[model samples]
Target: MKKIIFIFLLALSFGCSESDSASNDSTGQGGSLAVFALKDNYLYSVDHMKLNVFSLINGEKPVKVNDIPIGFDIETLFAYGDNLFIGSRNGMFIYSISNPENPTKLSSVQHFTACDPVIANSTHSFVTLNSNTTCGNNTNVLQVYDTKDLKNPKLIHSRNLMQPKGIGFYTAKYLLVCDDVLKIFNIENPSEPILVHAIDKNCFDVIIRDNTLFAIGDKGVYRYKMNPNDIKDIQLESETNF
Candidate 1:
């Protein structure tokens, strides 16, 4: 877990530079368990029950601008476009960041209590519910929602997995899901995701940058070179065990 966090922070710092800070509009990606996200010149974060907003306009010094009460057990934070998708033990919360300093709650969808981590794009939202941990319930499944209507998101599909954790988009059409192994799905049809490939690695989370894929699991941190043309052509680039 420590190694995963380290790699996530490293990735967050990689593309950011002096010019990025000067522009004050840098954005970064995080793994499934990430609690913070950057959008425009503002930094958004969530704790177990609160959503905090900080101003990065000063670059070096972050000013706490606002604090709003979110739901309980917030576990993950994902920023897409002008919206913030928050995953809590109970459900998923959607907030609009159109007003950078003050985010407005748009909508929320409840689910069974479990370890939830969520990610989203313009059309859909993906959430993984894991009951293997102490979060509660006996449900382990991936839930896909049609998010065209931000005010009312409907569950479009649900697929059971052994112990699904992190999820990411390898491309616009391909999605990477971490279960007992690393599963890659072709999401041509957002409602129905077809599993195309599975790597025999016990990954807990994954991060994709360009054509490079970084997966962290029980064994170690593994890096793979992705083939856009063929998913089967993905090759192992390196591995580092902690």
Candidate 2:
């Protein structure tokens, strides 16, 4: 019932013009486990092997626009500007949504088999590979790729992590990754992220909006107030246990 309500709210939220919506909100920039993302008047979703595009121009009724075959084991979707970042067991696929009704494949970055979740901006893309999952091997790490050349993403740096899941930017300089705990990193230099802080709560995913963060874990959903001035001054706001 709660899930239904959440989806319904998202539907209404995306009904408005793109200029009226906050692009960094949970409905726009989702967690790594997100299968669907809202961009402008369209919603892009993925199944195991396909990318589905839906037009929300009518607001009340969503019209399926296109269904393009992506690779298998497609697990997550993230949208930045006019591009869509897809995470699969095998690689990260970048697609151009400049044509909302007809998205075109741009390029792909192949990686080892793993449970992958990805996020990106114009400068760089971040991917977390969890080895504990069925899709992963023995490699568990966070990789940073220089996306200056979107067609050929070059891996610039990598750091070993526990079982990292969803990732998001708290600020342009701060990044949040979920693992054994809520780990925060200073991405002042996009290529070399330095670990800054870690919250004790075990989280699986996180949704960041401005200074507010919503973290999801096995036990429940937790919210925190992020201080933009102080990287280590995150304060718990609320929690909803399952």
Best by TM-score: 1
Task: Give the clashing pairs for model 1.
Answer: none
Which digits, one per residue and each the tens of the lDDT, describe model 1 over residues 90-162? 9999999999888999999999999999988779999999996678998899999999999999999999998
Output the lDDT of residue 154, model 2: 92
How does each model score on lDDT? 0.85, 0.82
Among all candidates shown, the one with the greatest lDDT: 1
Each prediction's number of clashing residue pairs: 0, 0
For residue 145, give model 1's deviation from the true position in Å.
0.3
- TM-score of structure candidate 1: 0.92
**How far off is residue 237 in model 2, in Å?**
1.2
Give all TM-scores, in the order shown: 0.92, 0.90
Error of 1 at 81 (Å): 0.4
